[model samples]
Target: MTDLPHYTEYDTRLAAYAVIRDDDGRVLLALWNEGDQPRWTLPGGGVELAETVEEGAVREVLEETGYDVRLDGLLGVDSFVFSPAQRSNGSERPLKAVRVVFAATVTGGELTPEVGGTTDEARWFPLDEVRGLPRVSLVDVALGYLAAG
Candidate 1:
């Protein structure tokens, strides 16, 4: 019998995000500072084990943007796979990211940047200007949902 290499187990990450837009034709975004270069993204992140997806989305939005949001409805889900070499965490196994996206409305709270967190800044960008901003792929996915809805 010939010896064979063992297969490595891949990891799956479940996250929640919100697409919040104001009546003034501006969309909320947070600067993701954990990567090589900071880029704008939706205000949300990994879902905690103890919370539901909806709860996670709300919590993440609050944490990143300092905005109290009420989720109106689920917009869509985005799935992407990162090869081991492409992962920022330096893991040897591939990672599958499953992101749950929701449409949300700001009920309260003011626009404030996150402190001591993965995101350093939060701001509202005019819809037309969003296309020129440096952002992650998730932003495009969320915007696609907005266009379709």
Candidate 2:
């Protein structure tokens, strides 16, 4: 349990995309595996070198949730200071994380799970449900952005 592959760390920072969708006035919320923070979050991950943000968002959505996403808009940028508990790789360090939220539409894809996905489950949640969750503020940020559009 001590030795694990953490997706995000302090020294090895990462950028993630917050994929959002509007389905009958609801959005998709994935119970993402954020290592120690283990909570429900949007699907996303680090941006690859030479890959644009939009590309990263799409890729992350597919990789994390097995969903092919079409980026509709960007929600916002968020920065978080790494804490001792958030380290997923079973390392002792704080992880500085930067995430770019995006409003995307599910153009085509199936609701499936990534191989060894961080999330144990994925499901659709209303904006109110997202707002009430006790976890990172990404969902709220995404909802606000979605409402803006």
> Which predicted model would earn the best lDDT?
1
Model 2 residue runs over 4 Å out of place are 1-12, 34-37, 90-93, 147-149
Taken over the whole model, the C-alpha lDDT of each candidate is: 0.93, 0.71
lDDT of 1 by residue, 1-149 (tens): 67623434778899999999999979999999988899999999999999999999999999998899999999999998888898988998888899999999999998888899999999999989988999999999999998998
Per-residue lDDT tens digits of candidate 2, residues 102-142? 77888778888767766666677776777667555666665
Highest-TM-score candidate? 1
Query: What residue runs in model 1 are displaced by over 4 Å at the alpha carbon?
Result: 1-8
TM-score for every candidate vs. truth? 0.93, 0.76
